[model samples]
Target: MSKIWGRILWPLAGFGSFVLVWYLVAVSGVMPPGQLPRPDEVVGTLATQFRDDDLLLDVRLSVLRVLIGVAVGCSLALPVGFLLAWYTPLRQMFDPLFSFFRALPPIALIPLVIIYLGIGEQARLFILIYAAFFASVVVIYEGIASTDEIYVRAARSMGASEMELFRRVIVPLAVPQVLVAVRVAVGVCWATLVAAELIAAQRGLGASIQDAANFFQIEMVYGGVVLIGLSALVMDRLLAVVMKRAVRWQDRVGG
Candidate 1:
């Protein structure tokens, strides 16, 4: 459809340009094929990878891990962020701890997590969850906290109860920001999932890329890297559509 292509044209053009530049550079002998695979060779490798029975399985498993972690992180973040923002005492008690944990990288905890949780799917899921939770909780909390006090005051002046003010005034305003946080959380989860898979997983894309490196399959490695970027782009576009739908007024204003 024209509308769909309109939305994607710029990104597609950019990607095409990137490939053109990469190919030109490689073909120019600036980087040998042994160092940087040609774009067409990478595409060929990707086509071959797609034909493999395990590629889809690996993608599915990685997506499953990301989804599980997103679910866990969001489930905890929403209620906790809301509670912390709503109650001063609770906010004081937890905010510093949240800040502390947020400062620590998920990769920093990978070794300890692997030691305690084992090199299983649980450890991978946990790492993703941890990263997503840290990144999301602060965003959501700030989103809630940043709700206009004027709106709350106006609602209260209209005899709205605290719950009503929060439900009707604060939450609706915060939802857009919260969704952005979720989008960011998704990206963090993907990165952490890849890091987790780099160590223990046998069939994940990251592991496949690592294997390709070991075997000197530069094309496969390039293809795997391209797949990861493409997957992220697809997800980001999907989320952008959802965000536009949810915040149509914002889009109208921006446009």
Candidate 2:
């Protein structure tokens, strides 16, 4: 169908344009040799790396770390966000603290994390969790807080108790927000991965990138960066699919 072709062609066209621009810039001699690799060079490095087992291992470890971080962080955030949304006093009491911590970059806490948890998996997870938690909690709290009061009043007028109202009305309305929070948390965790892996990580895309950079392997560095981006894009698309299905009942403007 024309619509299907349009959908497919548009993305391909965009990528094609980007690659063309990149090729032009690479050949422009703007940067020093080996500093900026052409797209083909990066692709070649990726293809070669794909033939090796280490790349797969790195990918698995990085994905696993992100998955675990998002799971734990979002789980903890849900209750905390709900409490903040539901209780005015609690929101007032903890809002400042949340804001303060949220303003602190996860990388800035690396030394403290290393000192407290040691340069181990725990420290890495802590950094990822910290990033994911703050990224999600704010969205979750705002989503719940911004729910339509008309729906709440209607439910109450129908003799719905607080618990029932929350379970049937508030929670359903907040489902979209919860899914969005997960997506945001996933993105934040990926962005913080390099920082997390700085804690003496043995294997991960971030660790591999660091290793490549140490050896002045420019192509490998580009490949690692590309892989990280592709991995994040895949995860985000999967989350988007889940979100679409989960919130299918909600009215929207278009597909």
Candidate 3:
């Protein structure tokens, strides 16, 4: 029970401290009025927005987009990552291209994406998918590559076939890495949401934030930012739980 309380209280205390600092900054008169609204004002805005149908729709749309993008992106990445790890020649051939694209920010490709895919759902999805795929593929490849050679040697000494080695030995060991890749991809997709929605989105948390900023509705902007953070945090926590259960066999220092 105490351990549970410690876990809850530590995070709550951190949030409280952050709110206190925000309150101090708001009262410091550093920025002009209507620029930095009080924490209370943002909270009120969030409460009011929560009851708004349009805001609810935006939440639903944003969640759907992220889900779809991560699903498609990570699904494709899994096979590609395995191939890259398994085939040294293929990895060498594509490594430079992967590195080049990985270094390119999704936002930087907005113009090209707009010109090619147009300012539509396809454009938005492309950005999200691009962000997720690169973010996950590297982790998956590394995880597979790092698998202990001793395990492979032991299985081979037992006369395990190539198919048996991969299916029974390699795949099981790589499961943790796959889970980690999904988590990384999910985080990247959420972080890229604003950029993805910048392509003329009609409804989404990112779109709402952009609209509010245009009107200088500071409280609404803060509310939207809070919503995005909280949404991402919730999803991350859920994924953490899934990961913990999925990788129970994994040994680590703390465990």
Model 2, range 10-83, lDDT digits (tens) per residue?
Answer: 87788899889999999899988879999999998878887874688899999999999999999999999999
Which prediction has more favorable lDDT, 1 or 2? Answer: 2
The TM-score-based order of candidates, best leading, equals 2, 3, 1
Better of 1 and 2 by TM-score: 2
**Clashing residue pairs for model 1:** none
Highest TM-score: give the candidate number: 2
Name model 3 segments beyond 4 Å from true: 253-255
Candidate 3, run of 10 with poorest lDDT: 246-255
TM-score of each: 0.91, 0.96, 0.95
The best candidate by lDDT is 2
TM-score of 2: 0.96
Provide C-alpha RMSD values for all models, in order.
2.4, 1.5, 1.7
lDDT of each: 0.81, 0.90, 0.89
Cα displacement (angstroms), candidate 1, residue 83, comes to: 2.0
Give per-residue lDDT, candidate 2, residue 50.
75
Count clashing residue pairs in model 1.
0
